[model samples]
Target: MGMQTTPMIEMDFAVIKEDFSRYLIHDGAILKVKIVVKKILRTAELTAQGYPAGTSIDSVNAVAAIVPQALKREPSKEPWDPRRDVGEEVKFEPQEEKWQEYMTTEGYRILIKPVLTKVFRYNKYNDYGEPIYSAVIQSITNIEKLGTTATT
Candidate 1:
């Protein structure tokens, strides 16, 4: 039999949680943020996708492009030590845009377009000693924010 391909799927999601972390580096602070979102599957879409009725999914990580705002540098508080001197205080913020407006709200909505690809395993095997193959989300594209309530 020929190889079967997974169909492209698009889904709506609601941002449930957001976490941010900053790491001090020589140039500036590297800001990393993680966002958790839950799929908001509609009845019509679920039926179209051949999913059974009353199907539900748990929260999953959201992958999107995050453009940080302008970087600002400030004098170090403890300048006694040479390594501690220089640009020690860095402020990083998300840019004011449609995709980023969710950062200022308790909860927001988004649409995700994901591409799937097959992953080949070298050493991983199943209980039957057969090579395990799985479909993986390679990349997320065309992330759009929904609703006008988040704009204001």
Candidate 2:
């Protein structure tokens, strides 16, 4: 019997983008990036012309015509609930202890929070029977907001 050994695979990766400045900090070095979550998709669907049984094809056949279909989801309206505690959180910002100091005399606050932008809707469902959403905070921007802001 011969001893079998697995072959090593050499993997090389690169970040191809128009600009990579945001990823670098003061020292012109890449910032520490943490991958919080990783997901692997195992499900996929294929849409092609359905060829029924007893369908014959020529070896030198012509190019198959591809068709496109449009799919849309109906927007849901809020149910008539007079006493709804809270609807849903569209954006989340973390506050610091000195958040109060950022407030101006006219009750305007200028605090530094991550600029969140919704990437896309996730496929997961929540307890409220609604589709879970996800977002990404790429960079920080200055924003002057009026009125009191909730801190938690």
Candidate 3:
């Protein structure tokens, strides 16, 4: 018999909201911030994924492999304020190359690709005494940033 392959299914999603945050790295010497675009799966895709009707399933593109540089920075002595240190809104848009791209108001650009990961509930076991696994779009991989790199 020939090998079986799962059919590809298109995922329909809608942008729900966006959030930004700043973090200190390298012993507080380097500052980083990233835009988290929240998206919810539509009815069709949700049903295809075996979710019940009216089930709310949300995902974000900010869960990437590489973190983006902060568009704005504050003095180390000053407490970090997200409103002032995170900079402008960044929009994540899908590209034809199968990679997602977003541009900061400062003209910096970041590229990322979606990754599907399987998660198992260790606490919950199946009748066969095996861990139950489910696939989820919880992160993105292969992140690349273009434009003037920030050093702050």
Best by TM-score: 3
- Per-residue accuracy of model 3 over 1-152 as CA lDDT, tens digit each: 99974343333333222332222222221211233444322233324423323322233434212222332222244433433443322222222123455443322233444433322122233333332222234334222234334365
Cα RMSD (Å) between model 3 and the true structure?
20.3
Off by over 4 Å in 1: 1-107, 121-124, 128-130, 134-136, 141-152
**Arranged by TM-score, best first:** 3, 1, 2
For candidate 2, write residues 1-152 as lDDT tens digits.
99964332221222111111122222122222212211111112212422111211111111111111121233334443324323343432222211111333423232322333322333333344444333344433232335424365
lDDT of each: 0.31, 0.26, 0.32
lDDT of 2 at 109: 33
Q: For candidate 3, what is the TM-score?
A: 0.23
So what's the TM-score on candidate 2?
0.21
lDDT agreement of model 1 with the native: 0.31
TM-score of each: 0.22, 0.21, 0.23
Worst 10 residues of 1 by lDDT: 95-104
lDDT of 1 by residue, 15-60 (tens): 4324432222222323233334444332323333234233233344
